[model samples]
Target: MDTSDILKKVRRIEIKTRGLTNHVFAGEYHSAFKGRGMSFSEVREYQFGDDVRAIDWNVTARFNHPFIKVFEEERELTVMLLVDVSESSSFGTQKQRKRDLITELCAVLAFSAINNNDKVGVVFFSDGLEKYIPPKKGKSHILFIIRELLSYKPKKKGTNITETLRFFNNAAKKRSIVFVLSDFLSDSYQDALNIAAKRHDVVGMHVYDPRDKELPAVGLIQVKDAETGLQQWIDTNDKQVRDYYNQQFSQHAQYCRNAFLKSGAELISIRTDEDYVKALQTFFLNRT
Candidate 1:
C-alpha cells in the first residue's frame, strides 16, 4: 500500500478501535486481566471491620493510634499479540477478509491495553518468526502496531504454530498476557502451547470463516490450498465428499479446543462475518 493509504487506514482503525476501548472494553479488560501482585500504598486509621492482621504496629506507635496497612494492585502489565500471517488468513468470503478482521481485533486489543496503562507488543508469524515489536507503553507505539498489522506481508506462506510458540517462549522472559490469533489450521503445536502456557497467560483467538466448516452443493469445483499451493477438484454435490470435508474441519477445530484445554489456556472462536465485540466481552467475563 502507498504511504497515504497506509496512514489513512491506520487513522481509521485508531478512531474506531480507540472509541471502543474507551467506552466498552476498558473496564472489562481491566477486570479480566489482573496485575502481577499487590504493592504497599499507605497506612490509614483502622476501621471497625479492618483486618486485625493488617495493623501496622510501627505506624500505630508513631501516631499513638491504631492504623492498618493498605495495599493496591500493581496495574502495570505486558500484553503480547501473537498474530498469524499465514496464507489461509487471506481467504474469506464474508464482510471482510480474515486478515482484516484480525487487524481490527488487534487494534482493539492494543488500544485497550494502552488504555489500561499496560505495555503492548506484537509477534507476527508465518511458519517462522516474521517480526517482533518489543513491548512499550504509549499511544504512538500502539498506533505503530496497528499500522503494521494493517499492512504486513509475510515472507512465508505456510503456518508452523510450534515455531511461533517457541519463539514467544524464548523472547518473553517475564510473564505476560499473550494472545495468539490464528485460524488454527496447522498442526503439532500442542506441546509448545502447553510449555508456553506454563510461563505465560496465553489465550488463543481462533479466527475462522463459516465456509471453511462446510461446502455448498455447487457440483464439481476446483480448489487450491493457500498454504501448500496445491490444487484439486472435488465434487461438492457428493454427500460423501461434503461429509468428509465437514468432518475434517470439525476435527481440526476439536484439536484446537483440546490443545487449549490440555494446556490450561483460554480459547475463543470469532467468525469473520460476526461481531467480535460480544465474543471478546464473553471471553473476558469468563476469565474474570
Candidate 2:
C-alpha cells in the first residue's frame, strides 16, 4: 500500500482501538495483567489496620511510635505479541481477512499496553521468525508497530508454532505477558508452549474463519492450500466429506485447547466476523 493509504489505515485503527483502550479496556487490562511484585515504597505511622509484620522496628525505636512499611504493586509490564504471518492468516470468508483481524487486535493490544505505561513489542513469524520489534514504550513506537503489522510482508508461507515459541522463550529474557495470535493450525508445539508458559504469562488468541470449522453443502468446490500452494477438488455435497472435514477441525481445536490447558495458559477463540471488543472485554473481566 502507498504511504497515504497506510497513514489512513493507521489513523482509522487508532481512532477505533485507542478509543476502546481509553474508555473500555484500560482499567480491565491493568487489573487482568499484574506486574512483577510488590515493591517497597515508604514507611508511615502505623494505623489500626496495619499488618503487625510490616512494623519498622528501627524507626519505631527512634520515634517511640509504631511505623509500618508500605509497599505498592510494581505496575509496569512488558507485553509481547507473537503473531503468525503465514499464508493461512490471509484467508477469511467473512467481512475481513484473518490477517486484518489480527492487525486490529494487535493495534488494540499495543495501545492498551501504552495506556498502562507498559512496554509493548511484537514478533512476527511464518514457519520461521520474520521480524522482532524490541519492547518499547510510547505512542510513536506503537504507531510504528501498527504500520508494520499492516504492510509488512513475510518471507515464508508456513506455520511453525513450536519454533516460534522457542524463539520467543529465548528472546524475551524477562517474564512478560505473551499473546500468541494465530489460527492454531500447526502441530507438535505442546512441549514448547509448556516451556514458555513456565516463564512467561502466556495467552493464546485463536483466530479462525467459520468456514474453517465446517464445510458448507455447496456441491462441488475447489480449494487451495495457502501455504503449500496445493490445489484440490472436493465434493462438499457429500455427507462423508463434510463429516470428515468437520471432524478434522474439531480434533485440531481439541488439541489446541488441551495444549493450552496443560500449559496453564489461557486461550481465547475469535472469528473474523465477530466483535473482538466483546471477546477481549469478556476475557479480561473473567481473568480479573
Candidate 3:
C-alpha cells in the first residue's frame, strides 16, 4: 500500500478503536489490569468506616486526633504488543484478513493504554525479530504504530515464537503488560513463554479464522502452507480428511491454551468474523 492508503487505513482504525476504548474498554481495562503497586497519597482525618489498620498513629498523636494514611494505585505502566507478522497472518476467509484484525486489535489496545496514561510499544516478529518500537506515550507515537501495523512487510515468512519471546525478555528493561497477538500456528515456545510470564505480565491474544477450524466439502482442492511453501492436493469431499483437519486444529488450539495456563497467563481467542469488542469485554470481565 501507498502512503495515502496507509494513512487512511490508520485513520479509520484510530476512529473505530479509539471510540471503543473511550466508551467500552476504558473502565474494563482499568479493572482488568492492576497498577504496579500502592503509593502514599496523603493523610486525612479518620472516617467512621476507614480501615483501622491504615490509622497513622504518629500523625494522630502529633495532631492530637485520629488520622489515617491514604494510598493510591500507581497507574502508570508500560504496554508491549508482541505481534507475529509471519505469512500465516495474511490468511483469512472472512470480512477481514487476520493481519487486519490484528492491526485493529493492537490499535484498540494501544489507545486504551494511552487513555490510562501508560506507555505503549510494539515488537514485530517473523521467525526472528523484525522491529522493536520503544515504549513511549503520545498520540503521534500510537499513530505511527498503527501505520506500521498496517503496512509492515516481514523479511521472513516462518515463525519462531520462542526466539521472539526471548528477544522481548532481553529488550524490555522494565516489567510490562505484554500482549502476544498471533494465530499461533507454530509451537515449542512453552519454556520461553513461561520465563517471560514470570518476569512480565503476559497475555495471549489468539487470532484465527473459521476456515482454520474446518474444511468445506468442496470436493478436491490444492492447499499451500504459507510459512513453509508446501503444497498438496486434498480430497475435501472425504469426511475422514475433513475430520482429521478439524482434529488437528483442535489439538493445536488445546496445546496453546494449556501452554498459557501453565505459564499463569491469560488467553483470549477471537475469530476473524466475530465481534472482537464483545470478546474482549467478556475476557476483561472474566479477569476481573
Which residue pairs clash in candidate 1?
none
The lDDT values for all models are 0.93, 0.94, 0.94
**Model 3 stretches with alpha carbons more than 4 Å out:** none
Query: How far off is model 1, as Cα RMSD?
Result: 1.0
Candidate 2 per-residue C-alpha lDDT over 141-192 given as tens digits, one digit per residue, 9 for 90 to 100: 9999999998989999999999999999888889999999999889889999
Q: Estimate each model's TM-score.
A: 0.98, 0.97, 0.98
- Residues 176-227, candidate 1: write the lDDT tens digits: 9999999989878999999999999999999999888889999999999999
- Please give the distance, in angstroms, between residue 72's alpha carbon in candidate 1 and its true position after superposition: 0.9
Question: How far out, in Å, is residue 180 in model 1?
Answer: 0.3
